[model samples]
Target chain A: MKMSFEHRDGLGLLRVEEPRIDASVAIQFKDRFHDLTQNGTGDVILDLSQVDFLDSSGLGALVGARKLLGAGRVLELCGLTPTVDRVMVLTRMHTVFPIHPDLVTALATRAATS
Target chain B: MTGPGPIPGVIGPRPWGLTLRFAATPVAVRAALSAVDAGLADAGAPDDLRARAQIALAEACNNIVEHAYPRHPPPTEAHIRLDIAADLGGLQITLRDRGRAMPDGPLPGRELPPLDPGDIAGLPEGGFGWAILRDMTRAISLSRRNGQNILRFRLPHADKPGPLSRIVT
Candidate 1:
């Protein structure tokens, strides 16, 4: 449940360093994500390029993170692997979060709009 | 450390498959998934099929760990037995556990949570497991007998010809 954060050009970038976010670490992931983004503002992009597997519990944690961010801020996701993307699509969670192909596209798109 | 292999004590005609038994805990479930994936890869299953199978299996096993074996009471040393058999037609899976039966003697509804983009906070955080299992699997069935719960399902191979022979078409 390791996460690294950086503020890149007005966008908060959070990278999930773990390879898998399953039931074993879902709670830790939610609590840690809250601690890191509690004071942040604006849209925060989560980079999941390193994650290979995410079960339902992990998906719940992602939703929990979004709730923790509140209404004003947004929790966007980028770089979902094949398996992770399938889970999102199957569960219809893709409709809720603004997903991007990669971090570069997310940053560029958000920068252009802002 | 339990890995993917055949259990000799079990009496049955097993052609091509692997069996693994692990403690019903989150950490053990995670490890069991990896082992199952490795076994599938060794059996030459395609990536797409393996990915979907893994997701469905994870949800099923997690249910057993979270619901069947209660945490507050600190359940006894309950274990889950997973049996997977792969052939040209598809992959068959059977999970057995001595834990408590499913709620009300049936599986949960497969309906996904309704998402309202306007109200982000109103969205659901859970209740997606049954939907995933239903979408990714075929011919799912559950039975409880003699204090044992046995869940079975099948994951059909892709229509494309690959390691697993394409039976449909």
Candidate 2:
């Protein structure tokens, strides 16, 4: 359930420092996301490189975090592992978020645009 | 959401099979899924197959923990039992629990929650479990009897073609 947050280049970078985000930690993950990004105005990018597994509850938490960020601000995702990517595709959630291949690309793209 | 009867004959003792029981709790279900994933890897399951197995199994077991075993009153001794058997065809999974029957005495329909991009507030966070289960496994069935719920499904091996797709490429 550990997560690290950084506000850089007017973007909120939240990295989940855990291997799996399942039912056991979904609630904590959403709460932490809210706590970290509640005051930020810019878009938030979630890094899922370290997370190998994400169940439906975890997916729900991700959606919840996005709602917490509000409608105007987008909650982007990056570095989804194979399984996580599969889940996103199967659920058609990949269409909902702007996904980047990695953190560097996400940051660089955002920085270049802004 | 299709079949609702006794688990198929395929779910029985096999030399390569394993059985385990754990309390019907999120933490324990997580541990059980992790153990099963490792076991699949150890049994030489391909990455794609293993991933699908883990994902589908997680949704099913979590449903039991979330729905079958209500947390309000919290049954005295609720537990989930898993029977996993691996073969050249694929893996067979039978999940059993004695807590509560499904709401309507049948499996829930396999409809994915709508993801209306425009309606951010109306987007669904849950109800994706059944759709995920439907996508990952085959011959999935559910049955409730004697105050027990039995769920069965088969995960195909990566290299093995399914019954309908057995033609050689």
Candidate 3:
């Protein structure tokens, strides 16, 4: 899986272009997190529009990303499809991260607050 | 008079056309579910039924991968089978593995505890697979035979009247 990162106005938008994030790709998902956090830009917004499936391992990786962001840094998620959204809802992780409907809304909100 | 009787879980007089094999890794579990999904579709199951079946099967396969294979190196095999019935009502699935036997009591029920915002904020990282399977299917049975753990889940005929309906009508 490949993750593309774009930075605008101090918000890091990470887009994941993968169809499934189950056990088969959990390792790559973890590795991508490592690379994303290496730059120490903690204000992150993940765009999951392309991901259609996610299991526990995939959920764990997102939590791990939150931990890596440290205190006062925010990690939000955007563009969750219904299937992926259901997993987050079932696991109750939806509350842990702020979820936005789209990248434009996330960016716009961040801009308004900043 | 004819050879041995048909296998216990297998239906029909064709002498058990089903075949079961052990998939030794998590990768294999995913492959097994995909194969089963395709097979179910090819066998003329309706789209809604196939979707539910696929979701349930994926959850079960993930459980085996997470719980059964935890800490075990790759190649920890789980048994998988392809069961087909000429009569749609008798369709069944049998999944078995040599991992630690699941608790000998009844598995958890299907009702999901309501999700509170605070609880969601503190939600633990794992332990969601069983609930997913439970919610997606009507019945699940677990047993241990000869040191191998077996899990069987069945879906009733889509058009059949359920228990409550039968009682009312």
Candidate 4:
């Protein structure tokens, strides 16, 4: 799994290019989360546009990232494929993290807020 | 006591058998499922049973990769073996892992909690695995032996209606 990170203004964008974010890839995801939070940037937008499939472990990684980001920080997800989106909905994680249709909207919302 | 208790289905002519070993990584789950799907097609298993088997196997393998080997380096190893009776009356699959032994506990059994209506819309992400296995398979067994945890599951043959009278009455 390869993750690219970029920061524009105050909003941080992390794009994951992994096809499957199931059990096997959870650790790598966790590691990336650790790297992202090391800077203490609190606000993040995860662009999952490239992820097609996700299971419980992937969900755990997202939830874990949210917890690590702390109260003031925010973690929003964008660009979920239908299958991945269904998994999120099935797990009810769709409610836990604010999800947007695309990265543009996600960043726009953050820009508007900040 | 002595040797490994006779490999599960050695008696008589074993109807169907499949053995595969793959890197204990997530990708292997998809590969394993594809192999199972192909094998079932060759064996002429019912479509529904094949689909269910694939889902169950994938979920079981995912659990092994995630829970058993959390945070481990890449290239760990796992093994899978499957046997299906000719009569289609029984299907057995075994998954073995060399990672840390899983916590010994009662095997997750049937009896799913009702899917709450409100919660259904935003299903909790984490706990769906065991539920999927419980719903899909007839029997599930887990054990730790020889420094490895082996999980096995079985599905009974589909029941056929005995007669028109039995079905109607």
lDDT of 1: 0.82
* Model-by-model DockQ, in order: 0.53, 0.52, 0.20, 0.12
**Segments of candidate 1 deviating more than 4 angstroms:** B1-15, B72-74, B159-169
TM-score of chain A by itself in each prediction: 0.96, 0.96, 0.92, 0.92
lDDT of 4 by residue, B47-166 (tens): 656655655676788777777777756443444444443333557777777777867667664433333323323333356677556655665888888887788777554623223214
Clash-forming residue pairs, model 1: none
Task: Give the count of colliding residue pairs in each prediction.
Answer: 0, 0, 1, 4
Please tell me what DockQ candidate 1 reaches: 0.53
lDDT of 3 by residue, A2-114 (tens): 88987776767789988767777777887887787668664889999998767666776676666667656788899998767866765556767889999999888887887
Candidate 3 residues lying further than 4 Å off, grouped into runs, are B1-22, B40-51, B69-71, B74-78, B82-91, B109-123, B155-169
On the 0 to 100 scale, the lDDT of residue B89 in model 2 is 67
- Full-model lDDT for every candidate: 0.82, 0.82, 0.65, 0.66
Assess chain B of each prediction and give its TM-score: 0.80, 0.80, 0.69, 0.72
Model 1 residue B46 CA deviation in Å: 0.5
Model 3 residue B87 lDDT score? 40
Model 4 spans with C-alpha error above 4 angstroms: A40-42, A111-114, B1-19, B23-27, B30-56, B65-78, B82-106, B109-128, B132-169
Model 3 pairs in collision = B24-B77
TM-score of each: 0.89, 0.89, 0.73, 0.58
